[model samples]
Target: MQKRAVSGVGLGLRSVHYDHVLSRRPAVPWFEVISENFMGPRGGSGGRPLEVLAKVRREYPVALHGVSLSIGSTDPLDFDYLKKLESLASVIEPWIVTDHLCWTGAHGKNLHDLLPLPYTEEAARHVAGRIEKVQDAIGRSIAIENVSSYLSYKHDEMAEWEFIARIVKTTGCGVLLDVNNIHVSAINHGFDGEEYLAGIPVAAVRQMHLAGYSEENGFLIDTHDHPVSDPVWKLYAAAVRRFGAVPTLIEWDEHIPSFARLQKEAAKAKEVQDGVCAAAV
Candidate 1:
């Protein structure tokens, strides 16, 4: 099998290492930014962080990953939020814009958490419609990522894979295919990981996410605070085999290590992806 070309690995862009990244312009292929971070200039742009992002964006490919958006929410779409997103997108010229498939809140309240939506036809229509609106506002296609959850709904009308498949199919949105999330949700919901991999339409997956998690009280929390665990690595290997070498990223939000350490994690993901392509070939 021909080895797939492994797209380079990157870290989530955080404020802590802005100076280091801008100064060094490290060897990572790209950086994934949280959309809300650079949306507005609360303290004005003369400061260091904005300057650093601007410099880094010029030097490296940047992708915007949002936690908010609440795509699956029952509330009305926030046009103002979409405006902010569009402004940021214009500034960074990100390679892609993406967020969780789950809703953060309903009504006006910001729950500040990625809460799962029931796997139902209603949710499929609701979320997909919002995604379509977002894409329209932003004038481009965006990716939706699978989120880890500790619970499932009793009123679910379909399997998680089926729900996601339909959403992407209907909205023409890309899939992020977070491997660690697949492993986490599979463990929580007692589903087969391989089946989940096989279920997703491979062509719709434009990118991938690999991160660390912790088991607490019989549940997996996406801490992203440590190294990628062995099981998650195996799962990621399976994903690379299925999806070929897509843009993969290593996320470490809390207790982030030094820039060199994060680069090591990205290197590991690249190595595994290369191995999969080699084996498949």
Candidate 2:
């Protein structure tokens, strides 16, 4: 299978590692940035954040990953947010743009967390229609990422993977399959991870994510603080096998580590990909 603009494994571009990335320009294949961070106050040149993003763009292909799209909210879409997002996309010209399939909040208030939705036919149609509008606004198809959930709604009608497959089928959008999230949710909700993998559409996956999690009371929390867990790494290998080496990213968000250590995590992902692809060949 042919990969997207970015191949191999990439790292999340956090502010802490700005100098190392700017000065050293490490061997990382690509970098993903939080879209809101560089959205830049409407009219300004985006000040320092935009400047740094410009510098990074010159060196590597950047993917704009967002946390605030709230694609599944019951409330109407936020035009202002879309305007800023569109402006950012214009400036960055990101290789890909993505946000969580879950909603953030409703009624004009922001909860600021990626909350899960009820997996129903109504939700499927609602979110798909919203995604089509979002695609029209952005002038491009954005990938929707599946989030790890600690709870489920009583009204859900299908599995999470089935819901995802429905969205992509309707909107023609891509999927950012987060392997670590599947590991976390499978443990929390007691579902078979392999079955979830088999349920998703293969060609819809445009990217994959691997991150660390914290376990408490036998429930896995999607905390990107620790290194990628052993089970998640195993799941990632399975994903590469099923998806044929799609562009994967190593995400470490909180309690950021040194650049060298971060690179080591990305390197480990690449090593796993190489092994999987080699064996398949």
Candidate 3:
């Protein structure tokens, strides 16, 4: 599959904005849709969602962001889900296909959450092999995202960032660096967000995510409902300084906002990207 360049700030394509996007053709550089939303018993074919998606595709580049790859799971690879994913990718011709680095299920049962993995050499080797196979199954290299964690394993041999860097290094896959997740995990786990960013290989960073987080009893949660927080914007600046102007997305999932509101958030990101790129020059 040929690579489609997806740069600039974008928004998570939600159903509420379908009319606005199709009618107004809002000036979004690209939009990413949850791969599962468009997949079903039909195997990535049919449905009004697709008709709308196809229409949107004619205007802007699209990316398939998945939540259930479970790349780190001990269960055997889910070829069925992968086939559906491949089918969806073929239909959408997305610029990028990405899922989280954390495992979503184990023992053939999905917990429906981004579960943390042990940061061990053995685990890193385990995930790298799965990523290589996934690339083969989909016939296109995909990026793995860093998910926020509320807990850590006592047996972890290295930091979360180190584990991620090793997987990309071994599989030659790209990284979808989520700036909000880093800050949330940092505050929740007591790690330095900057150090995490520094550990990731710069050139492998294919995309970036900015989102709002919530707090519950002193623990930070990776909820995408609110506006992007102050610290996340600061972390994003640091990311742009290191990774250059990589493609970015503002994710507002729970509390759906107006299309114009999403545009403003994306505009802020563009503004930040511009500032960082100019200062680096």
Candidate 3 lDDT tens digits, 39-141: 7654445478888888988888998999999999999999989998998888889999999998988987999899999999999999999999999999999
- Weakest 10 consecutive residues, lDDT, candidate 2? 1-10
lDDT of 2 by residue, 1-281 (tens): 12346798889999999999999999988899999898765565467898899899888888999999999999999888888888888888888999999999998788999999999999999999999999999889999999999999889999999999999999999999999999999999999998999999999999999999999999999999999999999989999999988888989999999989988998899999999999999
Candidate 2, residue 248: lDDT: 88
Kindly report which residue stretches of model 1 are placed more than 4 angstroms away from their true locations once superposed. 1-6, 41-48
| Candidate 2 stretches greater than 4 Å from native | 1-4, 41-45
The per-residue C-alpha lDDT of model 1 at residue 154 equals: 99
User: All candidates' TM-scores?
Assistant: 0.94, 0.97, 0.97
Which 10 successive residues of model 1 have the least lDDT summed?
Answer: 41-50
Residue 38's lDDT in candidate 2:
85
- Displacement of residue 171 (Cα, Å) in model 2 is 0.5
* Colliding pairs, model 3: none
Q: What is the total number of backbone clashes in candidate 1? A: 1
